[model samples]
Target: MTNFDPAALPAAAFEPISELGPLSRERIKTRLDARGYNYAIDSDGDIGGRWDDHIFYFLLLGKDSEYLQVRGRWSRTLPASSLGQLLVLANEWNAGRIWPKAYVRTEENETLGVYCEHSVDYEPGLTDAQLDQHLGCAISTSLAFFSSLDEQFPEAVAAAKEEIARLTAEQQ
Candidate 1:
């Protein structure tokens, strides 16, 4: 066995956002809005936005936990038959990528939806720079993963569009 040295590891510092008060869900929304990205606060108080064909959302876990939940949804839903394939793809992504792990879930209409989620928790708190970096990383990773899904299965996207049109016409 090799000898371990605790001093070899660099110490991390927790820098709180002095200019801002307690980081709440509302504060997260305000900061995001100030950055000029268009977003909507849903009935559940989660903030969501659409960018480059991907729908992304963020939910503040809680002030005590200081955790931010970020998720990205593919605009299209795949057929039920594609669940196995989707699982395979998600597993490949989870194995290769560290942030924004992929998952598949069934929607109310029985369509399979692919999603990616990442959570960041600040021990003491977060600095403004840290918040900004986290936000940027979350959004970009979501958009990139969505694009990767599209590139991997173009047919699923096209089928989803057709299904959307059919559903819309039925509603009308």
Candidate 2:
């Protein structure tokens, strides 16, 4: 087995974070603020804000990595029993949308909520227009998913439970 060396990779494949990450963060903050979002910079240096009652946040997950992730959370907790239905919704939504992937998460107490996330990568670095487009996609997609789940989850969960019951009864 030969050792793999990233140094052998083309310099064009990587961009320095010092010039990109901080600038991008500042630009994102400035843009979001300009849009009238009141955000807080968290302890891990992530940005958190709210839009239309849903909480949204952004994080630069790595120093050398070009990925910037934005996430939005629904305001309501999903009942634990509805998690399977949430996964089904996420899977269905993911198949149709390329950005702001959907998810369901449970806390220690078993309260669950739906979330949507999108990761933007700057390889050679992004132009201001591209950055704006990516940010817009993130915010728009996240809100779209959040709105879908908020409006539809209860009925979907009921339908899922009914289907599960029917399947179980048929098996019996």
Candidate 3:
């Protein structure tokens, strides 16, 4: 894995996917569904929508706030592939902090990914440096999860990376 330093990344380069509007949503949903995710729009419409299957539930967010919340179920099977894709997509979406305190788990209930629900603190004096740090943390955590998956699952990881690159490129 490359040492991704958000500080080294150009501000223009790390464009947030949320700014892309509905098109971004469509693209993300399509990619997940193509990977065999059973996509669903949350009926309550509380935390945007969700794309889920027997494995993982990706809670999409619409705005930046401190008190974000998500309600869902964790799959008995670990959705490493889906989680990897979610991380890439969340990074693209500029999700400051992802929710649902716990999710990723091995068949034996061993946690393999960083699963936590916390605020992406935004304050008056927030700087680009701070934002970059947050982004770097999220990206690196996702990379770690991606690395944990078996090497044979290259297609899913590759596709997730490709989609992230494509979406990031479109923002430029």
The number of the candidate with the highest TM-score is 1
Predicted candidate 3 versus true structure: per-residue lDDT over 1-172, tens digit per residue = 9898989978988765433222123443555455454546566532222222112233444353332222333222335546665455435434543432333434344423434332343422234444344333433443333344424356555665677689899999
What is the alpha-carbon lDDT of model 1 when measured against the actual structure? 0.79
- Residues 1-172 of candidate 1 have per-residue lDDT tens digits of 8788766666643333365445566667767876888888899878888887678888777648478878888898777888998899889888988888789999977888888888877656666666777788888887787888889889877886788799999999
The TM-score, computed over Cα atoms with residue i paired to residue i, of candidate 1 is: 0.79
Per-prediction count of colliding residue pairs? 0, 0, 0
Model 2 agreement with the true structure over 33-130: per-residue lDDT tens digits: 66777889988778898787678887766676467788888766766988887898899999997878888889767878788898866655655566
Output the better candidate (1/3) by lDDT.
1
Measured against the true structure, the TM-scores of the candidates, in listed sequence, are 0.79, 0.71, 0.27
Candidate that beats the other on TM-score, 1 or 2, i.e. the better one: 1
> What is the C-alpha local distance difference test score of each model?
0.79, 0.76, 0.41
Residue-level error in angstroms, candidate 2, position 142: 1.2
What number of backbone clashes does candidate 1 have, counting pairs of residues 3 or more apart or in separate chains? 0
Highest lDDT scorer: 1
**Model 2 whole-model lDDT (C-alpha atoms):** 0.76
Residue pairs of candidate 2 with colliding backbone atoms: none
The all-Cα superposition gives candidate 3 an RMSD in Å to the true structure of 15.1
